[model samples]
Target: MAKSFQNFSILTSIVTLSVLMFSQGMLDTAHAEEYDFVAGIHNEVTFHFRNGIETVNFPVFSTTSDIVSNIGSSFEVEGVVGNNPYLHKALDEAYLYRMSTLSGGNSFEYNYRYFDVDVNIVQNENVLKSFKYDNCEISGYSVSTLTDDYESYLASDTGFAIVNNIQFRCGGVGINLDSDKSSLNSESRSFTDYGPLPFKLAEDVRTFLTFEFDHGSEKIESVIFTLTSGFSEANDAGPSFQIITAVLPHPLIDNAIDKSQKVSGMASTFNEDFDVSVEFTNSQETLRGLDFQDCIVSGYDILTLRDKEEGYTGKRGFATAEILDVTCSGLAPVNPAFDKLSDAKESRSSQMSNTYTTNSYNMGTGPHVIATFDFDSGTEVVDFPEFYQGNMIARANPTFTLVGVPGSTPLLYHVVDNTQGSGPKSTGVSSNVELFDVNLVLAYGNDVVRGFDYTKCRVVDYIVRTEHDADESFYKGFALTDEFYFECQGYEPFNPKYDELFETSHAKTESSSSWKEKQRDAWGPGFR
Candidate 1:
């Protein structure tokens, strides 16, 4: 029998352990589903007065005058619990108080009554906070007749009910009053209760409150406000109010204020745009190492009737086939050389005749039979009218004679007639021909030549040549030729003369000679 009982006992113990484990698991799940409610670390203490009359208004009080000055002087009533303990703690730390006033009157009224109340414990300065209430039943009964009231209330009880009802309903009742003599003319009321009231307290109230730091005037580390409440006999339980205080780091509040002002002033002084300029002391030396890229400009403008009538209005008006003049100047001199040729050559020939007959050739003719011999003679002319024909003369040696001064390699010049024509022609051949002038002038380094700047250089003249049919009857067989000439003068010469007087005189004479020759060719009697 003993061995059988031992086996049953071991089995029962195993079942009990299993049940306990299951119960613990279920409890953990229940706890995980619960919501979080926290209370504020900083809270305010508030007092509410109550009278037995139901229709009368309850009085209100605050511990500190600063509370009324900051957030307004009005007080609101709310119904809650667990908030008073946090508020009481904050008031005691801050040492502030206030006196209650009667509604619509400047005088103060005092009233007392036993009332059931609720209080709210707030976590932060924010009004919203988690709260819990005390479980108790309180009825309106005179304290003078506790046992009589208890017996009368429990007359309808079943068993041991009267004693239980009185203990539960009238067990917890308390009063609170302000003892500060500075604000009151009379002594304040005191609370009398069995031990401490069975009020609910928050387990974790610190999580709900937040601290705000003011870095400017106060240089405080944090600011906190607490809210609490109480109940009056005339009204139902209501919500509590708040008291605020600032916690500073040190005594250097003035330095923080000054720093804040300086920062603001500096922000206002900032500008979006600033200009900077640097001037060189030695321009030539400073610019010696600098390099500039070449640039080209080409365009055309016209002066219309209105523009001309306006007399230099600096505006371009209507234009009729405006001619664009592109001149490249200020270029350093380059070696004069030929680059390439365009047209191909073709051999051409024409015949000419000159006749001379001998008088005695038929004198000895016999039997009245006179035999005459006819002689034919022809001459060949290699006619090349094309721009780059082999028979055309190439300008290999150009002479630049400037008086007594020896000349350098002359600049290469070419005039292309872009205008439509039978073949290549020179500007010298026709006055109405449209041509583009190409010149190889000097340029320093690798910079290509570009548009003309009068302050830097100038162009004097251009020479060209053209060829055409000499005779209208055999236009394709014979060739007529034309030639061009040019001269220019500008700036100081690259080569300086050993004798200045001789150089000047020689230059003057050469200039006159070239000018007179050009004029003679242009309008002389030979042209006419």
Candidate 2:
């Protein structure tokens, strides 16, 4: 069996950035080569491709000269990756979206050509650089060769030559977005460094495809090879590179192996410890020091769904979650895990609604404080996205305070000390246009069953719900909802907005638990 793909060597350009696919070899660009057979006969050929500089063999049989090989019969195209029919469709849709560029539609076109194998001897590089490159136009080309009469000598060579080299071209447009990424879990599929051809590789990139086949009586039906590969009109601000990744679909297996994988989209703004650090300027130095002694962080073991926007619900209890290396202001790390609880009850972690009541306070003068946290890689954040049924963890939690000088909106504020009373409804205040209430929930006897933790967790951010212009300060309507932090996690775990803001994502993970439930899950499944 053979896999098929198109839109090779696409190049697009804009003001300063230009991205395009570049690869060299037997695969330039060809459309779905359609071939018709005399029915009943299977044409077998050794389909060889470069898999990480290593030649992988894929022996395939086609009943017709069509470029699209009927997968699964005569032989099955096997690779380190599984075959995904849907993956191609989604990528095609995304390619179309990228091409639309909204208004730059006419500039795009599809060119078709046919080619006989073209080989170049690598005198300096040793070995043959033989590959398929465009040689002639294929407007009304047909591959009905040998004999249509099954009674005559059989036809097969025509089936082997048909290869799809369809290339979609784009120019003078800027279309680079990941919204077209498929929602399919990588687990059931495998990702490969897709080049123009599914079974080729570059010099340095170690990713490629391999193939195997299943001998069967059923013959492959139609093979349609559409276009030949060619992408032009590409200009770059400077030297550039692009990688084409393909998500392949997998066939059903009895005791399947690894087919699912994930990639995260966390912003590049968090530190390795998963703490949200902010850069703010103020009138004082040494704003708040040694604040960890009384600092507390409630324990939890669940994930929350976060809306990308400021004030709204994304999705709650989408998956189980975990928090580790909890370090506030560079304190010792505390690890907590939570179950994926339902979104029922109130689970929106809001600063506007949760700040509750604020009292004017004066905390003499001090210095300005500024911090930064590097965003984790998508490889890291995707390790436990609620979308996938797995437990997630925040590497650390940092504790900090937003102290204001005289005449600020709410006067003076503190992350923990500003709050009155105790328990879940405690309130804290901050008048800084960019300040959000911070809380430190203590961890002594703090592990609550079903994700809720009594430990004093630190309020991580300010949920600014009002919309304003650059000149208008958010402090005009600044008010924290309260310590009733609900459960919620956004798509970007390390989003700058959520940085240092209060989050109560475990609120709906598990409500007040009963004694029996605690005995079974308090220490939970992983405990000895």
Alpha-carbon runs more than 4 Å astray in model 2: 1-282, 285-324, 327-528
Each prediction's Cα lDDT score?
Answer: 0.21, 0.20
User: Please, what are the lDDT tens digits per residue for candidate 1 over residues 1-528?
Assistant: 999999999999999986654432322221211212111122222222132111111111111111101221111221111222322232232222112322322243222212233322223343221111122222211112112234334543211211111111212222111222232232442221112111121111110111111321111111111112111112222222121222111122212222332333245542111111111112122100101112111211111111111111112111111111111211121111111111111122322221222112222322111111111212111111111111113443221211100011111111211111112233223333322221222222233232111111111222111121111111121111112122222112221223443554333355777888878888967675
Show model 1 residue runs off by greater than 4 Å. Answer: 1-72, 75-104, 108-528
Instruction: Point out the worst 10-residue segment of candidate 2 by lDDT.
Output: 377-386
Q: Report the error of model 1 at residue 68, Å.
A: 8.2
RMSD of candidates 1 onward, in order: 46.8, 30.6
Model 1 lDDT-worst window of ten: 401-410
Q: How does residue 411 of candidate 2 score in lDDT?
A: 13
lDDT agreement of model 2 with the native:
0.20
Question: Clash number for model 2?
Answer: 120
TM-score of 1: 0.13
lDDT tens readout by residue for model 2, 1-528: 122222222222331122111122122122111211111111111111221111221111111111111111111111111122222332344355554534554354332111222222122233211222222212121122222245223433211122222222211111111222342223333323223222211111121111111211111100111001011011111111111111112221100111110001224422221121111112232121111111111111111111111111111101111111112222211111111111211364322111212222222342111111111100001000001112335543323323222112121223222321112222342232122322222111222111111122333322211121211111121211111111222211232234436654554455556655777665856873
